[model samples]
Target: MLASPGAEGRADLKLIEEHVQRMRWHVTRSSFADVGQAPAIEQRTGFTEAFLYAAQGFAHGIVAIGRAAITTDNKAYADVLERLHQRGVFLSYLPGTGGPEPT
Candidate 1:
């Protein structure tokens, strides 16, 4: 038996929502930068602005990835998606990727 198109679409949407929720949880659980993990500028008084900038870039990357995921043969967006994904992978290996929120 074959699933209806509507049912398949709903399943896809549900999966996407689950992925979004997981990403949100990870973002919320992470600190902007853990103590001694940030550069001098960020450590002293630059955290808010720095985090805002990083968040902006991350949001843009998400949009790029979503676009690429739905587009066919879109090289530019696909490259952006890979770069953003690679950055996240690299960060996962960093020493302070997760910890209590910075003070």
Candidate 2:
């Protein structure tokens, strides 16, 4: 995820939405690329980059949730953390995995 401005500021949901949209487009387009087309190179690279960005975002989000958990007693944050945990993002980076790993 991009470094947010200020420690305690509102999140830009629009930015997050755009990121999701971009990633979706990259994957969709890349999946349709043929073996040896000029556009295939671009599409494949975009897909790889988008996936890497998403993985990074998940890792950063987990860290933020932990910090929020200790610094405050917000039930909303707890709920969010639970949802994230349920999605298996917490353990998404175990042993061997395909594609780019989270940093």
Candidate 3:
């Protein structure tokens, strides 16, 4: 995750999308939005670096969450997802509580 301010930020979404696409993981806005936006608080005091830092930190968390998902079972998935979202690491798709049925 590359964090850019102003002009730099303009390319962030596209760059992220391109990276995922190149890996053959199509990026949907839903997924990206789920990633959330870097907070604008940095702009308040010419401290834009804060936003980038937050973004980078969140990116690391997202990576860790993905790793957990790949290594754990379904029961653990919801736990990780919840933790990530609470920590502001990643976004989630919310629906009714019931999940997929056995195929």
Per lDDT, the best of the predicted structures is: 3
Q: 40-71, model 1: which lDDT tens digit per residue?
A: 33232223332344445542222111221222
* Residues 1-99 of candidate 2: C-alpha lDDT, one tens digit per residue: 221234321242233334445544221211111122223322444323433443455232221111321123357435534554554443111113231
Candidate 1 ranges with C-alpha deviation above 4 Å = 1-5, 25-69, 75-103
lDDT of 3 by residue, 4-34 (tens): 3454444554554554555454343322211
Better candidate by TM-score, 1 or 2: 1
Query: Which is superior by lDDT, 1 or 3?
Result: 3
The residue pairs found clashing in candidate 3 are: 34-91
Pull out the clashing pairs in model 1: none
Query: How many residue pairs of model 3 clash at the backbone?
Result: 1
Residue 7 error, candidate 1, Å: 0.7
Better of 1 and 2 by lDDT: 1
Residue 11, model 3: Cα distance from true site in angstroms: 1.3
List pairs with backbone clashes in candidate 2: none
